[model samples]
Target: MKWLEGFQKLSSVLFILTFQGANCQLAVFPIGPALVNALAGSNVTLAVSFRGAPDPVLTWFKGNLPVGTWTLNSSSPPDIADGSRDVLRIENNGSLTFKGVPKHFSGNYTVELTKSGLGQALVTFTLKIFESIQNVTLSTQPDFAQEGAERFTLQYTMLQGVVEQEIWYFNGGKLKNSTRYLIKGRSLVILEPTRTDKGSYSVLLMNPFSSVTTHRNVTVLYGPDEPIVEALPAQPFYKVGDSLVFSCQAEGFPKPTAEWVFMGQILSDFHQGVLNLTNVQTSQGGVYTCSVLNGLTEEKREKNVTLNVYGM
Candidate 1:
């Protein structure tokens, strides 16, 4: 009886202590996390196990506000004024169930179990309700950026959900906030985007109930570096019937287009950036221009090579 008396004075605590007397016993044990997470519009159960008086009365509360109660062997729960009467259900084993949890119902929940002869036992739980993430899409402003540009932005949007965390990845590696990178609520910005930044980028959005990941391939347009024109023969003058080979090389993101101009006319046959002239003649000696153009960045560059032919 001393243990029963001491139990009666037990203050409100989370699964504080369990007691068992000769004929009467009371034990409340949690089966899951004390902090429960549920999705809005989804059926959720806050479960617990109890060993107490056969005709125990169980009452539920939200913080200091009384929620509802369930009498032993009762089919329906006793309602107070919480409006949970429509969705909340008390199970036979003293567990609470929400037919479809509401986002606004997230808060601390407590359960009180008592009987006439025995003391009261209390268990507390923290409930969190979140909306499911759906229709997630990742995109970049302008879809492409030029190298050395001030900045580029990547953003993601979701149809519904409360994001607890935002994570970004670049080229399969985790991205950290740095001088070159900025993370906002739903966007990521990269300063001075370079060719190295042209790769796969992904973002992860998470919540209590669900998480989603979206990916996009970002493009960073760079150049057509200064073109270089090379000739096979190093001599300034060429002899008739001699073989001459000219090649133009350049570097760029989209592979710059090379055009060979001879005598102010585009040489259609030498569009591949190489010109082959065999059996060189005195009339064929002039200046050759190799023009390199980058369609993406609109960058143009050119190199010139001169040939002088003499008859021996």
Candidate 2:
């Protein structure tokens, strides 16, 4: 009942984005952005400074929700003490602290101040747990590439922390939730990784409390196994109006598609597995590529060859 008196004193503070009482003005200071991101199972601490002095009440929130305990009530010169048992909320050191920020902790928060009237201010921080592991360790297999072996493998071990599962992810660009990912282990090793697999590769560790991620570079092995591409002019020279034949070959678990890339970056419709160019001219000279991609497996292989047009 007496706590209601504390609300009357906080009226001096300005309220922004009211959520409660009329006179209970709440103002969330240093509210820079509405969205944020972080890795899972990682220890993350957020720094927030509030304004409005004289009998002010403060609360801590995660994403759009609140975690642990928010202290807006201790009348004793701003000191942190226990508020509840089952629900963990801390009010100390003039700020709020949450141990090991997790996925479920992502949400919006409000610091409501209630005097005789109820007024609330909002200072929300969104936590998006990343895939970086703080304790566990990760390593890739078959360190060296044999030029064209087209094999890239990565393995991981958790030195500390609890790991529910580990996943290997490969991407040519930015990694997304929809990006291709595989459950990698001793039994499940990475497939043939060609030059294309040299992009960003990362590992994710999933757990109930937190999630972590690690990144590594994938190297292509040399084995002359690259899709061998040969264009016309197999001889010393060639003439115009001549038939240009381009063939691409590669070896891997699943076969890859080989295509011809023209000057316009267009595909010459390959019907019945044959790429034929009719009446080839000097302008048709450019980089021809054989690209094999299976959207399902997220595996792709490509080889390039230059066509030289000469006047015979």
Candidate 3:
């Protein structure tokens, strides 16, 4: 009876050792990238390698939900026929591939591998799908602005996934936030824009997958300012035989037109904002007026000057 009890214990130990050896025979390891970054409207593959006799059963799951199944049969090759969705495919090496990946496809995936004599092995992966920006557009709130305007807003819009970063540029140089410039969400505001603000502006929109840019040209319009009239000698007194030249200029957009006026008569001989006199006389010492006109703004400005000629 003692010998029989000992033999029974030995048999149980042998059986346990055989079971552990069979379980250790099957080995599985992930072969490809653990994180898959796929672009929208593209294809991606998640792969794995297995070593054991008699092909193992491969099952793919996404967030605890079964997505696909593959069973290797000796008679025929394994295919994606058992996939739950048409976009999913199971390759011969027990890899899962997705075609035409979309934004919603980004998530965690798990591959459950099982063999007849081995414990199940699980391989995990993280998938990220990114969409590129498209149909980008840039515009200003008021297309046209006058000098000393309160403010103006530039709006940017695009069609794409979430934007990770946004950069603004003016005339090929990066723009920084200043007291007069404010950057808001998808908009740029300029306080009291003047003629100096006229230039080409661009915005760069970027995501993890790709980046896009848009450009716009802005022009700030102003009116004709006070005209400046000056004499060639820069002094009010000149000799009778001395030549005198009077010039008029103003600061304005669209270039202000100037007309010279003496007393109540317009000087037709001096048309281009300049009046030249060969011989100065006491009779021409009266007040001379320079009138500037801005046709676009329909605004007029003028300046007056007095010249005194002395006999030599």
lDDT scores in order: 0.84, 0.52, 0.81
**Could you tell me the TM-score of candidate 2?**
0.31
Candidate 2: regions farther than 4 A off? 1-25, 31-57, 61-73, 76-94, 98-110, 114-118, 127-155, 161-312
Error of 2 at 164 (Å): 17
Give the alpha carbon lDDT tens digit for every residue of 24-68 in model 2: 343455434545555554555454554444345554544434344
TM-score of each candidate? 0.64, 0.31, 0.56
Q: What's the count of clashing pairs in each model shown?
A: 0, 43, 0
Number of the predicted model whose TM-score against the real structure is largest: 1
lDDT, candidate 2, equals 0.52
- Give the poorly placed runs of model 3, Cα more than 4 Å off: 1-37, 44-99, 104-128, 134-146, 152-163, 214-218, 222-226, 238-243, 262-266, 277-285, 297-300, 309-312
Candidate 1 C-alpha lDDT tens digits along 133-157: 8999998887687787899999998
User: Rank by lDDT, descending?
Assistant: 1, 3, 2
lDDT of 3 by residue, 93-210 (tens): 7788888877787889998878865768788999888788788899898877567889978898876665768898889988778987888899888889989889999999887788
Query: What TM-score does model 1 achieve against the real structure?
Result: 0.64
**Residue 265 lDDT in model 1?**
94
What value of lDDT does candidate 3 attain over all alpha carbons? 0.81
